[model samples]
Target: MKIGKSKNLRVGEWVVAIGSPFQLRFSVTSGIVSAKGRSIPNGSDSTYVPFIQTDVAINPGNSGGPLFNLEGEVIGINSQIYTRSGGYMGVSFAIPIDYAMDVADQLKENGYVARGWLGVSIQEVTSELAEALGMEVPKGALISQIIADSPAENSGLKEEDVILFFDGEEIFYSADLPLTVGAIRPDSKVNAMVLRDGLKKTITVTVGELPKDPALAFNETQQNFLGLVVEDQINDGRRLYIEGVMVTSIDPEGLAYESGIRRGDIVYSLGRAKISNVNEFKEILSSLDQEKSTTIGISRNGNKRILSLNLSK
Candidate 1:
């Protein structure tokens, strides 16, 4: 069967789905492209896939079937449907063939799919945020936080910067930026135009291959002799966007925990020196005066405090 790209598909265009649902063999249904680039939380374990939404009758066995255009060329694969009674409710979704093909190509070549990744957390720019940032329009993605040691942190991207364009493509939405970046091959360098303090500037970032393990993607972590395993991430069981070295684990009888540091505590600074990323934090910690009392700043549950610890020489 011939295959076509879904990017050329338009909303309200006539489309067809061929599948077998509920023991019905070779069932066919028709629908229009209700929307594009829809994000839905599902069991697919895919957070970056922008599904093509439709009203086609997709259910049960229909999942792996083809969604074709009028020319009988497959544009997508029927994936899921929105329903309350465990039945079709007119809203269905499909994985865009173009994206599927890209993954397919990778799987065929490397036996594993590797997406382009930029280690940063982003949120959509709103009107109030735009006004606060002195932006003329509430478009583009606002960098909320950057992961330490990742491409974003190594590059010039900073917290609170508004990314307007990436690699010549305008980022109309935060979600758009992910899809745009994911489409690029890993290790590729791209120019990102950003607005910082009401000024526009371009930053070059080398895209990285998306890691299968979140721990690895973080580019953060080190097992220290202090009986503490630290990372460049902090999670309060809700979200991880803060900038600081974090204690992933620690020995209960270790000097760090005994010094009042706990797992999940964000190490903000040491010896009055502000910590930037994991590497710098490790460097500072290594060079600390042994057995001498040094002040360390930590934040837990939005509360900041200073603790004194002394390492034996």
Candidate 2:
């Protein structure tokens, strides 16, 4: 039996796991409740997901196996193990039945899981960022970029804005933002409180349907780091419009990547010069003589950021 999803799980439940350890087949292990709602890093990109902690003596090949209650009702799936000698260390972890069910459902329905999107890119507020910018303690998610015409952008979210709460939920860490916001239903208007320039501002945004495909938005290869493909920002009418080169895609290895520059960042100005279009962007790049690192200021998510990047000759 494969148990997925933790919504129905309870503490103090007896559970069993069956799998192979070190190629041992049909191994069985049992344990009582250890803990629940523990978080683990999802992948290399630094996202986190909550998991169930169990002491079921699990090991390799045990992953994806079911954890059963004494009643034989599956409660979790053995997923990971903590080991010092390439073997079970008596401590193992499982994806809760509910969470697993959610993952499986999403994968089956959408070909991928659609996480709730706040439509903003954020960074952990640092003390220097706090002091340099007069923040409280570097504990909130600072908006580094906001998607244009996105739910966040439409709701007036600005760059450099520090998010303190979402739907009355305190956002102390970056990881919490996604989980809390994703739990909210799409197409619902919700309140978000943020500290903009040290002042708290509340805005309401209707959560948009999250895209089923992650690659569609991230497919560009030469766009700026601020999340926009520009053409020009300088028509008498366009100056009011704020245009620039049409972004093609992000340079995956460019300075934009390390600086948290997303796929749609728009190039408005390099340093202080206004780049009207792609030709202007070329001019700016051509003007550079392979000297040292240059400070690039980009416009993203209705805000601006300065990044120092070393240019390769």
Candidate 3:
């Protein structure tokens, strides 16, 4: 059977899905492509798979089915469904057949699949973030943190640089970046266009193999202090009036970053003073002695850690 590429798929194109739903063998269903390059959050797996979204009836056991084009070619493989009721709810996703075949080939040849990586944590360019960054429009992925000694750092990809294009592919959202970078082979040179300080510049990088442990990119609100950017803990559509500030971004060379402070750390206190919000944190930071060592309390992955900032040194 001919394998088709998802990049060639057009929205609203008629397609057929073949699956065995609920013990029904070779069940057939029809639907139109709803979207392409859809990022369905499924932990880290979604970062690599640029899914094809459709309204096809994909139920339990429908996964691993072939999604065929009208021309009788397989374009994708049914992978998942988005449902709040534990069943198909009109939104189904498929892994592009071309991508699947590539992985299959790698597994057959090397016993494992290797993906290219640029170790930079990023966030979506929301309207507020755009204004803050002096961008005319909300687009592209904004670098929030650069993992130490990673390819991104080696390439001089600085924090706060907005990556508009990578390897000639435009990154409209943060999610688009992972899929684009992962497709390239390791040690391959790629040019990335970035917006920095209201200017656009291109930087060349040699892509590296994704580490055994992947670095994730995430986002939050604003409060710039102690060389750290933070926001209040939010839950269920509201800021949880908790005694902590969630770290979003930090200057790579700043004391906070060097002192074991990292993005996603929940700073609840400095020394003995409790931090209730961004404003309070700022106030506490203003009163700190730049020449004195200070201990800070933070929570990471549900574990509390006390990181010392030896500012005096």
Candidate 4:
């Protein structure tokens, strides 16, 4: 069977799906590609699969069916639907043939799938965040945190670095990074272009093997001060590393909570003192004057801003 390149797929282009929905064998449905590079959240994280979204009537039995282009070439595999009533609701997603073929080749060769890892927690670059980062346009994957003892850390990749390209290919979105990196073999060296502090720089990194178990729960330790419970953002064997202190919970009646401090906010700087970890955050709190307002720097959703709080009693 002839295969079509998903890279050539254009939005609004007509496509077809052949599947057995509700026991109806070999049912054919038609639709146009609605979107691309959509990131669907998976638990505390998200899958970077560049799904080809369509309005095709896909149902339970339609999964694993081939999606074809007008030329009768296979372009994708019908995988999921965005329905709320356990049936099709005008939205369906397909796995791009490009990615599916890569997985198939790996499974056929080694009987297992092995993906490359870059050891960085990334976020999308919004327009507001791009302006703050001195970027003319919002693009690329913004590095929010780097995993310790990983390829990113070893290659000197730091927080706030915007990964513009991987292996000479431009990263159109944050989700594109994982899709590109996963296709690479482990131990392979690749050059990445990143925007650091408003300047572009190239760094070479050796990709590592994706761990068999990648999900690690964050072990939060509570320390109450100013009505906020702060803890180190630690998730052993995972990529949930964040500098400064993470707010696990906030007491509604506490000063910090009343001052608009919310849970999940990472306090990077207290007043003028920069916080590098949980200990520093504690030390800064202990030495505070408690008689004046203080400003704290926080990185939330890739946008850095200051929050003022009346710490005085």
Worst 10 residues of 4 by lDDT: 214-223
Ranked by lDDT from best down, the candidates are 3, 1, 4, 2
Query: Which ranges of candidate 3 are over 4 A from the true structure?
Result: 214-313
TM-score of each: 0.64, 0.52, 0.68, 0.63
lDDT of model 2 at residue 125? 64
- Write model 4 residue lDDT over 209-304, tens digit each, in one string: 777653311111133457665555543346643467666545545677666666567778898899876678888888888888888877654456
**Model 1, position 179: C-alpha lDDT score:** 66
Stretches off by above 4 angstroms in model 2 are: 1-56, 67-75, 81-93, 107-112, 131-136, 167-170, 179-185, 188-191, 197-202, 209-313
lDDT of each: 0.79, 0.63, 0.80, 0.76
Order the candidates by TM-score, highest first — what do you get? Answer: 3, 1, 4, 2
Q: Number of clashing pairs, model 1?
A: 1
| Residue-level lDDT tens digits of model 1 in 71-122 | 9899999998877678998999999999899889999999988888888767
Candidate 3, position 123, lDDT: 66
Q: Write the per-residue lDDT of candidate 3 for residues 84-159, one digit (tens) a residue.
A: 6788889999999878888898899989888888877776776777888899888898887787888899998999
Candidate 2 per-residue lDDT over residues 1-313, each given as its tens digit? 5443465566666688877767888898898767665544322221324567777777778898888877677778788875547677777788767666776887888786665566776655656677877775766677777777877788788888888888876787654676566655567788889888678889887776555554433321123333233333223222344454423234334454555545335656665677766778877866765665666666554466676656542
